[model samples]
Target chain A: MELPGIAFYIVAFLTMGGIYAILCLALNMQWGFGGLFNAGIAGFYAVGAYTAAILTSAGSSAHLGGFDLPIVVGLICAGIASGIVGWAIARICVRLKADYLAMASIGIAEIIRLAIVNEEWLTNGSLGISRIPRPLEAFYSGRAAEVVFVVFVWLIVAVTFLVARRLQQSPWGRVMRAIRDNEETAASIGKDVQRFRTETFVVGSVFMGVAGALSAHYFKFFSPDATEPLLITFLAWVMLIAGGSGNNLGAIAGALAIWAIWSLTEVVTQQLPPDWATRSSYIRMLLIGLLLQFVLQRFRSGLFPEKSPKLRISREK
Target chain B: MIDFINFYLIPGITLGSIYALGAVGVSMIFGILRFAHFAHGDLMTVGAYAALTAVWVLGIPALAAIPFAIIVTCLAALLADRLFYRPLRDLPTIYTVIASFGVALILRSIVQTVWGTDSQVYMTGFQKPTIFFDTFRIATRHIQIILATAALTVALHYFLSRTRLGKSMRAVADDPDLAAVAGLDTERIIRWTWIIGAALAAIAGVFVGLDTDVHTNLGWNLLLPMFAAALLGGIGKPLGAIAGGLIIGIAEEACTYPFFGDTLIAPSYKSAVAFVIMVLILIYRPQGLFRGRLM
Candidate 1:
């Protein structure tokens, strides 16, 4: 590949890697801090992506789109939309045991998918939406446009990272960890576990939605296929767990590392005989699944384990 | 009324039987293993494909392939437990749940690679439904599936209530620590749970193939309804899961009937029926209809 070609490839890689980093951070908030099992990250993601697509895309007769709003507005609305969904799901399912919550969340994701596919009037069915605007697209074109978008995505990732890090050190984070470590003890200490969980879930879902919107903007199109659970939900879970669940930096590292493995393996798989073409994707999925099992068993805490934030005050006081 | 019975009720029962069979496994696993086996649906897919292979290689009827399917699926379930789930047994149940999600993907991918992604069946041509009393019409496979499920349910009831191993299995599910303290062979009971669960799942897979086509997403698509059935029946209560499965399956098919001059819900959204029912059950009765475990 040429230098520019390789640079362009790197840009594309980082853009997706950044988006996935946001997803991992969002998941870290829920699973890492809150200990809530949200297997429906894809649902919130779809909600956000579709919301942005419907709001910011050019007017179309195929689906619900005519607003042609600003990309910023679309992005904000995406976060809000996903947050609402997360709140509703958490209100009902957050109180359930971890396993039940996982089951319920998967059901919700499936329902969301069914609606997105069947409700053609709203989402254009399987045809998907096109002509989604990229952030500041008018200012750049071609490779420059790609670079600009990657920067935008990384900007969001930086903001997300800062916010997540702040939350991890906050008193709220301490309460969340307390509840996660032992709900009964947290409750005994006068913390409303349910309310805190609901808050954490909603907060996490907002970022997941933002990540989804970023993807929509990156692709300049939106489709149900992009919201696949295996790619979005499962990948994010693997990334967080592999990267180190409780630590913000681990989330980003895991996202980039896993995303690299996910995308680069295609290069090798594409070299196989033509007969193995269709089966290669499945082969990758198998490898990824095995990798998850390996990481869970061998690493357990991931590459970057969580470290408790130290108190600023001295015991002498 | 006859149209309702023929078009709605009979298909509902047929689908419910499949769900019931699959839900039994889910309920038993939940009861004994204390984790939602998300890969259970894929085990059904594995069974369907196994039977498909048997039919292709042996030139035998699909029904005749049940034993092979059961044996293959039983092995698959046992291998997954030993390789993926056993080490995580000491950890929290969520780890196993996540691992099962991975297993679901692995199983689905394996089936896709082996069988190809296209939908297939044991027999391609459609068969005419047998007429009952010159008024009631039912497909032959439906009758067979329903009868087989009924027999299995009866056998399961007897095994749990009468057999020593079955009793020990229930004892472990009820309270693992107590069962262990009581000198029950927890590992042995766990093995039986997997065997029974895998056997029923294989039969259900074959029945689904009989009713429709064997596709990669066949079991994954039915997973929500099966889980709904298990939840409705009460998690851990095998009998309750059967009842739950029947109600969910029937409701899913029947809800689309043109009862009031139009269908209550569009057929395209039939899958949503299961999700709605599951949510309602979660909100109203977490213990399930049979008063199983609270969680």
Candidate 2:
């Protein structure tokens, strides 16, 4: 089995890295900007992916497959659906204080995964939908197409980062920060805490949904198995936490760093002696766990701390 | 209908008992510590494996090995709390939550490294299935598990309500600062909390292993259900935890029944069923079914 070309691998890495960076950014917005600990982002991501796959797949009855909608539309639809779900969850759960919110989000995520698994009519059950259409297949060809798609995804990342940064600086951003820092004080200042949280959650989930859609198109195949809470969800959390939670750039950096590490470990394992290779996957998990522990212990602020806001003085006065 | 009741109801209760024991441990820890310990499931796995090792490798009797497993698990929990959790206790609650994940990862890795990823069954084979009249059948092992859980729950109730140490535990759960001011040794209470909670978790693990195959992922699978139970019973309430566990257990089993003709939900959806129940409870009554204090 010859390995794919280096360019192919690079494109794959960049695609995954970009998608994850988008997810981390979403999480950073919810967790860092809004101080919502969402343990269920993977659920939304999976939902987005499945929604796109089911809607766009060829030859399906009852479900909305065979539409062959443009990739941009599919991506947008994914974001809308996830945003709606996130809004519903927020409305129900935003009132609950910290820790309970985490538990609730985790519960919701598990439920979504179960729904994907059980709702055979809609999600194709455990067999999972495959042969998803690539977005730019008609316009571009071959590896160059892949390279273009990577750039396209990075463009999404760039826009998302810019938007998140803008939101973080706006008045609404200040309100969100205030809520994160102290809800009572924010409320005292006439802020609708729940509304802010709900909006933030919806917006963040939209990004997650878009990321999921992008990822599905890149992979060209998807399964309910991909949506399982443990693998994708936890890894994203690990990335956001490793980077500064509030910093979009840091989230991207962390995604790239972790994905590179993960890819490098996989490659290294494959090259190792056959006997050692078998256990390398478990070793990787252990290392990740250990890395999480070390990071949490040693640098609680993360590699890139969220920069303090710049203050301006009235020099004219 | 009678057959369905006989088949599913009793088995569900037995399963519920096991979950209740695990949830009780989780509730107690959360009540006192004020953070969700994600590693609790792995601790359950460790406990089950510890007992398995004692029986299979060390040649101890199954009955004797349980106590050993519980002790070992308790010690491990205590050590983890002291080394990993204690330092971060003063940090942000999120830090503790993250640390729990780390602890879970580390424990899982250790288990995999030592036991390998392959599933293990307790060496003790079934002696015989109990005959309950002519229509119903029950397993002797399950009967033992249910009875043992009841006994433990009762003992725990008495210990918490009647005994001096139990009162201290409750005091700490209510308000650690006040309890400390009241001259209760808060640190000792915490240590004992981990010990007892871990011991109960170990018992649940052993019971689960007896009922089904034991694997590294067993604890991980149990985590959500345990949380459901704890949340349903009202986060820090011990009795609520037990009740919540039983309810979730029965609900999970019953959900497997065919709702519409020829459309039966699979047992794999048990976790999902638990989550749904939990979400409804959370949405309507965030304080939980029992309305106990938040952990």
Best by lDDT: 1
**Global fold similarity of model 2 (TM-score):** 0.93
Question: Compared with the true structure, what per-residue lDDT tens digits does model 1 show for residues B63-136?
Answer: 99999999999999999999999999999889999999999999999999999999998898778999989999
- Alpha-carbon lDDT, every model: 0.91, 0.82
Query: For candidate 1, lDDT tens digit of each residue in A158-185?
Result: 9999999999899999999999999999
Docking class of 2: medium
- Score candidate 1 by DockQ: 0.86
DockQ of each: 0.86, 0.60
Best by TM-score: 1
Model 1 off-target regions past 4 Å? A313-317
Per-residue error at B71 for model 2, in Å?
3.2
